[model samples]
Target chain A: MKFIIQRDRLVHSVQEVMKAVTSRTTIPILTGIKINTTTEGITLTGSDSDISIQSFIPAEEDGNEIVEVQTSGDIVLNARFFSEIVKKLPMDTVEIEVQTNFQTIIRSGKAEFNLNGLDPEEYPHLPIIEEANLFKLPTDLLKTLIRQTVFAVSTSETRPILTGVNLKVENDELTCIATDSHRLAMRTANIESKINGTYSVVIPGKSLNELSKILDDTNELIEIVITENQVLFKAKNLLFFSRLLEGNYPDTSRLIPTDSKTDVIVKTKELLQAIDRASLLAKENRNNVVKLLTHDGGVIEVSSNTPEVGKVVEEIVAEAIEGEELKISFSAKFVMDALKALEGTDIKISFTGAMRPFVICPLHDDRMLQLILPVRTY
Target chain B: MKFIIQRDRLVHSVQEVMKAVTSRTTIPILTGIKINTTTEGITLTGSDSDISIQSFIPAEEDGNEIVEVQTSGDIVLNARFFSEIVKKLPMDTVEIEVQTNFQTIIRSGKAEFNLNGLDPEEYPHLPIIEEANLFKLPTDLLKTLIRQTVFAVSTSETRPILTGVNLKVENDELTCIATDSHRLAMRTANIESKINGTYSVVIPGKSLNELSKILDDTNELIEIVITENQVLFKAKNLLFFSRLLEGNYPDTSRLIPTDSKTDVIVKTKELLQAIDRASLLAKENRNNVVKLLTHDGGVIEVSSNTPEVGKVVEEIVAEAIEGEELKISFSAKFVMDALKALEGTDIKISFTGAMRPFVICPLHDDRMLQLILPVRTY
Candidate 1:
């Protein structure tokens, strides 16, 4: 097998696929990046049992020749070494060929690297995904969806189902929800990728996180297909496949409260900063809990106290405060994450009481809501 | 203690001293920063018994008020907490005051932090050095001296004395040497800091590294005062003190070769890159050994081979080749480090034999020399 390729394009594709490669894979062949070249292009694939990423570079892109003097062949090189070699090549173009005993030779300028490669026949085959029921979402919106809700997914294995984000499509709307029992993030958007029927799936949060890193924030559509055990996301020149977690996601609809005894509207930036400062000392607690108290006249005081460490108090003016004056304690990290995810200047926070869960949303839109269960403090 | 200081100035000073503070201190008070205020300014000190750093923010600088409404007092606050608080203060001016029981109130804008402070009297005192003799070197020059030799220090604790950089003054010159037995780096300069007599000391490689980070790259003179057990570096508003290593540094003068069988002149950058590529496969071996051989036509070949992994070969054209043909193997890491430290486009490398130690120096200068003993290959 022999091919001469542009070093930069090869380096970029290798890096993108490398995000899904795990060095800890017990299966030796899984540690390698399978390289296959056809008349159309070269495809580099890296995967573990749970996630796989494949990137392609065409022989000719927009009349520009990217790869030349190529013969169709297949070989797998150790991802780590291959990535480093392509990045440090001395020239703009690199030449790679395979000799006897599956030995691969990579030549560029005056440097030549001979790698003991693995047989492509020994590599695992990517599941053939059918071209039916293609559900699509714009790249930027999908990334935003992942970023806004992925952080709330459970990192604990006690409930493996909670470790995945739940996606539901119904009534021409797409809803994405992530919860770790203590906090929940829910976002609903009008589907830009019109579909035929309603569907639901649970995708591992870890997979979505890795996929988010490789995806560009563009309006280009990403087609997704889900089978019994696997889900695939297809973008231009790239394919991402992830294993779906087994088990049902817990119902979180009843977890969010519908009414509140106290509702406060405050500047998102001011409240976020105040909570951040108040939580500085509370960080030792790990839960990072802080208290928010509504006072007379439109003032809110945020504070946290760790007996042996110290205490912090931050005050911010509220645009309006109504209903009962109250105090509640919850994880400062949860509130801060929710605040950062909201793009609006002002947010409306509703608290039923000190112990009950509270809800926060943008004043101008209700497309997303974040809920956090208050921590019990004596 | 009470002072209203410019937030930026306080932040910078705190960051500088915090580098010397370690959280694993057995003495609880050492984890806190000792803050002392007088009519002149406020001094912040942090230490871990071995290294101490003190930064002072004067009451005024360049006719601008950096600190005001200050009262004389002393207190110690946890370095980690204090550093984080000062960095995130909401306003340009932060107010810090000491109340009863050493309780400290730090207020900026609408944020207030109450820190559980300790008595400054309990903090460890830095060693006292009699101000009898002082030697000075430009800040940038001292940093260069450090960068040129410190990387060769032995990281192994088996030979404790080899873990330091030896600094000696004699015959109107200052010489710095560091070696890990396998390799030695020697640098010398005409005494810019005029002295009456010769002096010698061994400074811990770790200490010099930390000090290098805290120092600015300006040419302002820094005063160095060495006592029996301590060395102090004093700048305009900063003081750094590091304890002297207990044992004498190893003598490496006899290790450098005085004569050579073959000499080759090559572009420093080209040689460095060739070794870098050749070493990519050698990195897994940890020792990272690479071999170089001279060819018939002013050409040098750099290569590395790992039994089961891979191998790389690179060739570079040399400017000159003289005396004899030779092939030598050495740690690629040592050669790369020496090449990076030398500031010359063309370097003359001398090889005494395949098995003997070789020396490298810039063709036009002799202020510094690097020697590396070749490794045995089966």
Candidate 2:
């Protein structure tokens, strides 16, 4: 493969594909990014066993020559070192040439790097998904959905399916849910779809996070294609593909309570600060538990006590309070996560009792909700 | 201690002192910060046996009240938790009151933290240094001197003294040297001292690093006091004390080469970039060895080869060259560190031979010098 490309364009494409390059050396070819030159343009692909990313540099962009290909061939080079060299190269244009023996030479300005390239045929090919089941969503909305639910996914690998965020779609509405049994986060958004379809899939939270990082917050629409075992996200000239988890996602609908005996509405910032202060003391305890007590008339108190770290208590004025007064204890980390996922200025929390689970949702929106199970504090 | 201190002032003092607080709980009291309130001001001190930092929040600043002292007393609170609370408190002023039985109540706005304070008598006392043997240096200069040599200190505690930077003062010049046996860095500056006596002391690199971070880039003069077994740095109302390592530091003067068979002058930036590029491939090898070949004319060739990672060769045009042509290989990390410590745009390198030691110094100054031994490559 031989090509002369603009340094900025090559660097940008290399960075996008480099994200999927495997750090592990079990599959040596997986650590390299495959570069393919053709009459159309040049494509760079990087992949591990779980996910793959491909970025295409068109021959021309905005009437400026981006890629000039002398021959069409393929070679795989080390992803990390190549990306670093391109970033540090002190020139506006770079020349890349691959020999018959797979010796890749990259030159920009006075700096030239000769990297031992692997046969592109040895690198795993990205699974192709038919475009029949594709749907479009705004990049900003997709990023927001990922951020709100991804943090709540189970980090432990005990239940492999729980490590992914469950995506459910019906009609034109998309809902994402993530939970670790201790706490849960859910977000729902409306998107423009070509047809009414009901589908469910679990995409690894880590893969979604990486994909979100690569997707800029532009008005551009991302086309998503779902196959039996893999899902593809295509935006602009970038294609991100991830394999779906092969286990059944646990049913979480019954875990969310349908009713509550007490409800309290408080300012998000005030509650966040109070919980934060209480967490300072709670962090010293084994369970990291923080207690919340709601009294008559819109008064809420957050407190935590540790024998070695002492105690902390803070009062927050609630917007409104209804039903019976109650007290409950839960993990400060779980509560903080639930509070962060909330979007509105004021949040309404519903409690069934001290021993049961409680629901946290925006003051007026019911589409997004978080549930946290209270710990039995003696 | 009973006082109402401005939240910002209290937070700033807490942050400075907390740097010395021990993260390990082996010494319980060392993990706590001692707060003392008197008619003059409020003092916060934290110590971890090796290092101590004390920051005083005066009762008033610039004719404005900063702390209101209602009672004179002292208490020790958990440093980490207290600092976190103070930083997140949503109040302009914080009220602190010590109750009977070592119970302390800290209130700011609606947030109240009741911490279990320890008896002030249990806290370690700061060493009192005599003013007879003292010197004054600009804060910025002191920070710069520390940064230039600290990175070369040995991290292994096998030789306790090698983990510290050796400070030697003779006549009006103050020189600091640090070496891990493989490489050495030395920096010298002129300072004003009250006494003409020669002084040598080894200060722990960790403590100096923390002290450097707290010292701002200002023209303020910092007072240095050398006691029997401790060194104290006083800047304004802040006192930083570090215990001296109880051993003799090895002499590194003989390691620096006096004369050379080859001498070369090159732009610091150009050489740095060449070393960086060569290091990319060299890093894949265990030793991270990069070779530099100097020709008769002023041309220097940088190269590195890793069987699995390919090879890199780059040429840098040197300003001047002398002596026979030679090739030498050394750790890329050492060269990078020396380059980073250098201040001038142009650098002068003197090489004894291909197998001998070399010295790198700024082109127009002798205030700082770095020496590295060549590595044998087969």
lDDT tens per residue, model 1, A38-132: 98889999999899999999999999999884689999999999999999999999999999898999999999999999999999999999867
Best by TM-score: 1
lDDT of each: 0.91, 0.89
Which residue runs does candidate 1 get wrong by more than 4 Å?
Answer: none
lDDT of predicted model 2: 0.89
TM-score of chain B of each: 0.97, 0.98
Q: Which candidate is the best by DockQ?
A: 1
Flag clash pairs in model 2.
Answer: none
**Candidate 2, A218: how far from true, in Å?**
1.6
Candidate 2: share of reference interface contacts reproduced: 0.80
Chain B alone, candidate 1, TM-score of 0.97
- Compose the digit string of candidate 2's lDDT tens values, residues A1-378: 789999988899999998887687689888888999997889999888788999999998889788999989999888888888888776799999998689999887777888888988888777867888788889998998899899999999999899999998787888999998888999998877764477799999989999988999987889888888899999999999999998788899999999999999999889988998899888867668999998776899999998866898888889998998899999988888889878989999999999989999999999889999999995
TM-score of each: 0.98, 0.97
